[model samples]
Target: MRADIVVGLQWGDEGKGKVVDYLASLYNAVVRFNGGPNAGHTVIANNTSFTFHHIPSGALRGTKLFIAPGMLVNPEILNEEILSLKQLVSSFYLKIDSRTSLITPADVVLDKKIEELKGASSIGTTLRGIGPAYSSKALRISPRVVDVLNESFDFSIYKKLYNVEFESELWLKNAKKTLKDYASDVREELLEILSKQGNVLFESAQGTLLDPIYGTYPYVTSSNTTASYAFVSSGIPYKYSGKVIGVLKAYSTRVGKGPMPTEMSEDLAMVIREGGKEYGATTGRARRIGWLDIPALKYATEINGTDEIFITKLDVLSGIKELKVAVSYNIDGKEVENFSPLENIESAKAVYQNLDPIPKLYASDISYIIKNGWRAAPVQMRKYVSFIEESLRTKISYASLGAERGMTVKVE
Candidate 1:
């Protein structure tokens, strides 16, 4: 069995962790390929909620987890996450790639300093040192996990270079002690799994719209948040990568500073936010809500080569009288159905089409809808689903009615 990739199609916080947790039982291992503590993947199972920063969401179910070299490791945060999980799920192992880069205390200090310098124009970073750590990796000056494990390495060099105050010796000692049990070369284990035809799940952080290369510039994250990075990030072959599942919300929401063409009125946004509990799992920042942007969703599906789609939080819109979908973008007075990352996206306006709201749906109702098409679905909801299928030309394989692991309905 090849690896199945799960990614977020919209901005971050697309309920990826919940979907991953639901699907994790089908895979032998869940591998985290990119991003860092900046990502907040929240999962709910057995009425217990978990907000994962560095650990894979599958770990809550005792699935074997691997952190790849493409990811940035913040040892302190990871240690805290691990310790917290141990209180609930007892039997779990986290395998960390030796080549993974470390996010030093200096990097954290530099991150806050950079954000402080930006002031009001800051990109709304989580200030978790992810950007600085990635910058260090790109410059080939970052210390790897293996380097941190070495007895001779001096982490004080970072404190001196960045002019940040950190007890490097003490922090390093603690981190070293914490990570000693998890550090290893995970590539060999992944290879063995593939060789034995065992299924793997490569869980991605953030979303396609936050991807550095494909997302809106200057507002994107430091790492590639697409399924295309699975091979390189996991040190696995392209042949082992199977289906790519792109997870999207019923509507759009963004956390940081960037142009949101379909942004809604504050009162309506607040209602949706409260309905969906739209807050960053990592930062706890309230998200900016908007109507579903079809053009952006289509563009993301095309870029990620999404094989199947998972739509989440459909229940959040149950009580709304009407729903507005962004059918296209009017940029410089020209209407376009296709969307490209823009340099001045703030000037773009969304062309919306309103539809009637669906009656309230339960988790089982959604399961029936998925198993049988939209034959029995509400007329307005049918139109919404049809529009999505036609726009992306992909199958809607899963629908999530709530945040719990069992709240998902499978279409395939």
Candidate 2:
């Protein structure tokens, strides 16, 4: 069977974890293609909330989970996550690629020191050693999962290269004990699964706008967050690649420092932030809120070849007096619609089109909409989705009303 991909269209924290969890039940395996500890995908299932950093959100659905080579594995975080899952899930399949890069304590220290040196120019990173780990991998000095399992692996290489001292012995011992069981030839396994006609879901961590190459450079995450990279990271041939499902929110939100042209007023932002619980799942920092950015959304969809869109957190906009969508960007007095704002992000100003307000929805209204379909939604809510669909020229397959898996409306 072909592999379908789920990716975030905006900046990080686009509620992709919940989307993956909701869709995982239909697939046999879920593969995480990129990012690492810095990614926080929160899923609310069985009335229990799970914040996943390294594991796929499909864990609760008992889907087979694969950590691909494109990821950086932090043993401590993965260990804690496994322990937590054990309490709730009886048994789940998990495998890590032997070629996956390892994140060591030395890398964490290097991350902090580099951030400190950046000072005013710091990228507001999670400081989870993601950048440093990727850097080491590129330099061919990073240890892979298989290296940790090897008896001849040396830990002093970090000290010799970075001039830092850590509890190398303890880290080594714990890493071996934590990862030895899960490490395997994930490429071969994925191939075998595809040969057997098993359906797979590729779950991407960060959003396309934060990709290291295509995103707002220097301010973007360390890994490639685009959907096309999913095949490369998962070691699955492009021939098996299937539909690309792009996930976004009713409005845009970003956690770290970057140019968000459609940012709203501080007072309005605080209202939406609190209503949406807009805080970074990994860093707990308050996210910068903005109106839906159509230009950026269009760019993301085009780059990812998104076949369908899944919108989340539409409930957060209820009760607001008015709603606005950024139809274009004004750069140096020129109104531009096609070019991405990131081309001149610092000077680009968002041009918004105001729409009617969605009346405050009660719990019963949300329940009805969830139980029925989009036709049961408020007229204003339906209009909002229509505007977005027309703007992106993509069909919206799903709309999430709340955090629960059941709080979703399947579009007819």
Candidate 3:
């Protein structure tokens, strides 16, 4: 089998890791295609919880895990994540694509410096320097693994250049640390994995809307988080053309700052927060909660060339007075449909259309959006699934009724 992609359809924190973990067992390898330590994916099983940052959710698969070249490697956090995976799960092999870029101490320093200077106006960065790293890459001034690979390369020259350019860019103004020795070859390892024709699974860290190019400007994450990132990072052409799986939350939630058209009130937020545990995996921050924005979901599905969609967390919306799905937006007081990379500024903001919520609560502790108890859990669960099928025009292939792997339902 070829590459199968899994990404969050919402802004972020869309339970992509859990779904990836569940599907990992089916694939021979799971590859993390993009992002740095800024993403956190939580997977719960047997009353034990394991969260991962900068590691593929498929690392839980105990297969060959390859960190593709598209990723920005942070050794410190990668080490912790690997150790955590070892403790949480049984066995897995992780290899980095030598072509992958490195996120040095300078990057983090740069990130914090930007936030420190920008203060409140900062675009809710994780201080991981992802945006700056990507920007440097675009400007053709990035530091790559190849740079560190050349034994005879002038590191002194590299340092002077990086320092001068980095300073000129104002990325790491207050930088106190400097990288001494960086020697890691992800190319050799990736080639070895590829030679085996081993099944490669590409895992994406951020959601679709968070991509720097497509997401809200200055607020989006670095790099294109879409499934295509896997192709670019893995050096495998058409890897995802036939095997992409877009992961969508039954409802939507975004963490930190940004314009969220469907954001809920604090009280309503409490309901979803309690029901869904919508918190960031890396930052431990509370996520912005809202109902499914069909237009937004459709945009991601189309752009990613998503072959299929996986709607998760159906158990949480068992019963509420009424539920809302953002069918389209009212931009500039005009009704329009379709998910374009919005630049209308005022018009780009989403306008949501409301759908009635079901009054029966299927999961009381999971979210407050549902008021009805899950008395007839199975039958009620089916009803919720049908609603999604019609709204998103995608099947509810997976349903997470409870937290454990076994508690999930398979609709297909």
The lDDT leader among the candidates is 2
Q: What lDDT does each candidate get? A: 0.86, 0.91, 0.67
Residue 193 miss distance in model 2 (angstroms): 1.3
Looking at candidate 2, the ten consecutive residues that score lowest on lDDT are 338-347
Off by over 4 Å in 2: none
TM-scores for all predictions? 0.95, 0.98, 0.83
What digit string (tens of lDDT, one per residue) describes model 3 on residues 295-405?
A: 778778777877666667776675555566777777777777776656453354566655555455444443332223333344545565676677666665666655665
Residue 102 error for model 2, in Å?
0.7
Decide which is better by lDDT, 1 or 2.
2
Tens-digit lDDT track for model 2 on 295-400?
A: 9999999999999999999999999998999999889899999655347886889998999999999899999887778899999999999999999999999999
Clashing pairs in 2: none
Best by TM-score: 2
Q: After superposition, how far is residue 210 of candidate 2 from its true place, in Å?
A: 0.3
